[model samples]
Target: MVAHEADYEYVIHKFETEYYTYDPEDDSEVKPGPNTPDINPKDVKKLPSSFIPEVKNECAQIFYRFKCPGSGLFHCILTGLVFDMTREAELLYKIIQWDESVLQPAGKMAAGPLFDIKCCEDAVRQLHFPHCVKTQEALLSDGLLSVAHFTDDAMSFIKPLKITDTHVIVDNPHLSAFGLVLDFLMGIWNKQVKGQVLLFLSPPNHAKQTQNINVLLLPRNIPMTEVSKHHQPSHFILVPSACNLIKNTTYTVHCPVANKIQPKRAEFDMEFGPNYSPTFVIRLPMNTDEVTLTIRDQTDTEVWEHEADLTDHLPFSADGRIPAEKIMVMLLDILEDLNDEEFKKFKWHLKTEVWNNISPIKENYLSKADRNDTVDLMVQTYEITGAVQVMENILKTICRNDLVKKLSTLRH
Candidate 1:
């Protein structure tokens, strides 16, 4: 373990021979390996008590010729165990009430491949245990053998995390379609553990300035966590943000941890490999923020954009005081009609709701010809109206946040 910590990049040196791999990543089972350790029914007693039960139960006889990818530099021990219904229920209870703040201390033993037993009392006797001072007592006692599977996600001298449910994001360099990782993550989530799937990073080459992450719920027993578009709420976890003001930008998150007014917060930039799983804090403006937007504009509707001075943008002030009354006023400005010609240079919307809600048409002011002609004109110009609607739909796209893209899609 110490060696792996220092250089995890170390090549697995052990030779693989005659073993099978039931890979969790893909549903596919790998072909068995060659030149590997042989542990079968006959060799079970010869196995050391000091060894993990997985080494005893799931060796060559079951896995026969299992292979690890890469060169002969990695050495991994994948073990499986069998447990009764009693252990399964007990283990489930402990995991739910798990304290997020501290590491859980379970005896460093893992159980695998559960089953029903002839008797709960006899089942407890056969369960494997870790080395401990009171281990003999713990074994003889109820709790240790009571639980079937012990998840020791990884203990550390420092704070450690033991995780079970995982969603992997492979950093595929050559793949073009970006939603593939989310598609893959969608594969693992289910109702058994209604876990929070937070994707920490993004696919490379894809540039979306605002982090586009979607979380979803897996319907009961349905393994896939579909992109919950209609019912699910995808909120932007706000951070104190400012544009182009070049210092190492920082913000005070109203941290509720450790009640001392301000708890020291930490930051994590994305690294290699998978990005989907239950996580504490997710990184913002992920690498996928790297997209190029080609603006598409309508012939009738003009658009404009301004890099508003951050000093003036409301909610956040030059002198940071977010006033109570300012919320509605600020939101109204978002709906305000800015028909300035400069605004035409950017992007535009029909503002239909605002137009309709503000007032009903004043029919009395209209002549008979004018009244009938207005409706007639709209009907005659259905093609123009369709073009405008198409333009409005295009601007509604998320990529419109990018000025360049906001311009291109709005263009012919």
Candidate 2:
């Protein structure tokens, strides 16, 4: 007799905090405040239990748990999703990748990440998902933006109860995979929206005398913090520019100095997601220090252009001993172990000039600087080798012997 067997994959997430911090207002402006009529103040006896879920897959699939004490508004830091809980319950939710082509028949395209939420039926009174719309001048007023709910092998669109600057609020009668979509049939394809162009350069292959550069075309609403967290190894080139892009329009990147460029053309798709793939890639000679990048539309008209210098953004030391990204990763890992107070002490011990250069934007670096920001500042101010030495001395001085040992071991 033959035996039948099946295999299942499971992802587990653990949280240490009893209740996550609930700020009344955040810089992102993605969450609705208590005074918002959507949330009743009386239901919020305590802040709703929140967690930042860990990514489980390369596609950035995340799994988390929301343990509600009674009933209140819960916000997700990653996907900008908010839940209004009606009763005490534990909810398991995740952001999953979907085949966007399914929406073609509906004459719509995705504008945000798709979320799969599971909990007791009717436990959630409403769900608010962040949208990429830059303004409500025409899209919202014309009723082109809506939520796509997938259930029982079928998809349906839901009109939002309220549309704000950051989020689209919808009533949650049934829990399933939901995402934000725009109906192109409603003349959305002809309209241009605010966009951004980001550049990332890979470490040069000295042996082959070649390098690769990635160009990303994204909506202006996507947070830089999220993009930086996902792309750690590549050196991000800061060539800021205002861009206006049309959805589904073909765009071509031209670089005269590049050795090779792939695809020749790429369609501009609005992707607000857990995964951000490069729009175009250009290959150049290792010694080519500067290049002129131009993005032209299908009509052969230049839409965005920039000249970026490759010297400062290169991720290597003068002697090519260690890559800056490696040192950055090591420093980030070490700093993660330090508490807020310890981190403050470490910063206080730094040289005056170094501190000033690290945080030129703010007077109080400790309050605004995060682990990535600190590591980036250290690497930028001091090269790879100097950054390593400074971090080692600070770790030792802070009495974080464990982190110091780890740093030394990793450095060698």
TM-score, every prediction? 0.17, 0.56
Model 1 segments beyond 4 Å from truth?
Answer: 1-42, 45-119, 129-208, 212-280, 286-412
Candidate 2 similarity to native, TM-score = 0.56
lDDT scores of the candidates, listed in order: 0.20, 0.63
Question: Candidate 1 on 52-139: residue-level lDDT in tens?
Answer: 1111112111111222221111111112111112221211100012231232233322111211222223212122211111122212
For candidate 2, the lDDT comes to 0.63
After TM-score superposition, the amount by which residue 5's alpha carbon in candidate 2 deviates from its true location, in angstroms, is 51
**What's the residue-level lDDT of 379 in candidate 2?**
48
- Span of 10 residues, lowest total lDDT, candidate 2: 7-16
Model 1 TM-score (2 dp): 0.17
What lDDT tens digits, residue by residue, belong to model 2 across residues 171-199? 89589999888887777665777687877
